[model samples]
Target: MTDPIPEGAQEIIHDTWEDGAKRSAFYTLDGQQVGYRSWTAEGQIDMEYGIQDGVQHGVFRTWHENGQLCELSSL
Candidate 1:
C-alpha cells in the first residue's frame, strides 16, 4: 500500500466538515492533499484514506461510532 503521509507533506490542518465530522488533512508544502483521517462528532474514527497524484489510492478504512472497524478496502 502507498504511504499516505509522504515526506513531501509538510502541513496538517485540523478542521470540521459540513457533516460535523472532524478531520486532519495532510498536505504538501505546496498544498497538495495527501490523505486524511476523519472522526465522528463523538470522536470515534470514522474513516481513513490515502491519495496519490490527486486521486484516491491505497488502503481505505472505516469504523463504527462505537469503535469497531466497519470496513477495510483498497483502491
Candidate 2:
C-alpha cells in the first residue's frame, strides 16, 4: 500500500535547479521531512518518494515526462 500523507505537515514548494520544474517537500510541524513530490517544468509528475519517522519507506516511483514509468522501488 502507499504510505499515508503525514497529517498536520507543512508543505514547501521550490523550483528545482532554477528550472521551471517544481518540487514539493512535506515536513512535520516540528520540521522533519515526510515526503517529496516533483514535477517537470511542464507539470508532469516526475517522481514521488515517501518517508516516515525520518526513514524512507513505502513505494517510490519515477516517471518520464511522457508518462511512462521509469522506476519503481519499495523502501
Candidate 3:
C-alpha cells in the first residue's frame, strides 16, 4: 500500500473505482470520513461529503476532491 489509511482515525469513505476495486479514502485530521465519491461496480457515484466548522466545506461534488462546481462561500 502506498499510504495506508487509518481506521476511524478521522475519516472513512468507500466506493467503487473505475479500475474496479472497492476503493476507500481516509482523511487528514480527526478522522471523520470527510468524503466519499466513487462509482459502484455498476457505475454510479456513491458520493458523500461533510461540513467544516459548521459550514459545508468538504465533498461538495459527486466528484471527490473536485467540487469546483460548488459556489465559493466565506464564513
Q: How many residue pairs clash in each candidate at the backbone level?
A: 0, 0, 8
Best by lDDT: 1
Worst 10 residues of 3 by lDDT: 66-75
Better of 2 and 3 by lDDT: 2
Tens-digit per-residue lDDT, 1-75, candidate 2: 464346676767745645645655554556777777777767787887777787777788889879998988887
Model 1 score (lDDT): 0.72
lDDT of 3 by residue, 1-75 (tens): 112223344544444467756565535456344333344455444443444543445334443333333332222
Candidate 3's C-alpha runs over 4 A off are: 1-20, 23-28, 42-48, 51-59, 63-75
Q: CA shift at 62, candidate 1, in angstroms?
A: 0.5
Candidate 2 root-mean-square deviation in Å: 3.0
Which one is best on TM-score? 1
TM-score ranking, best first: 1, 2, 3
TM-score of every prediction relative to native: 0.66, 0.64, 0.29
Query: Rank by lDDT, descending?
Result: 1, 2, 3
**Model 1 pairs whose backbones collide:** none
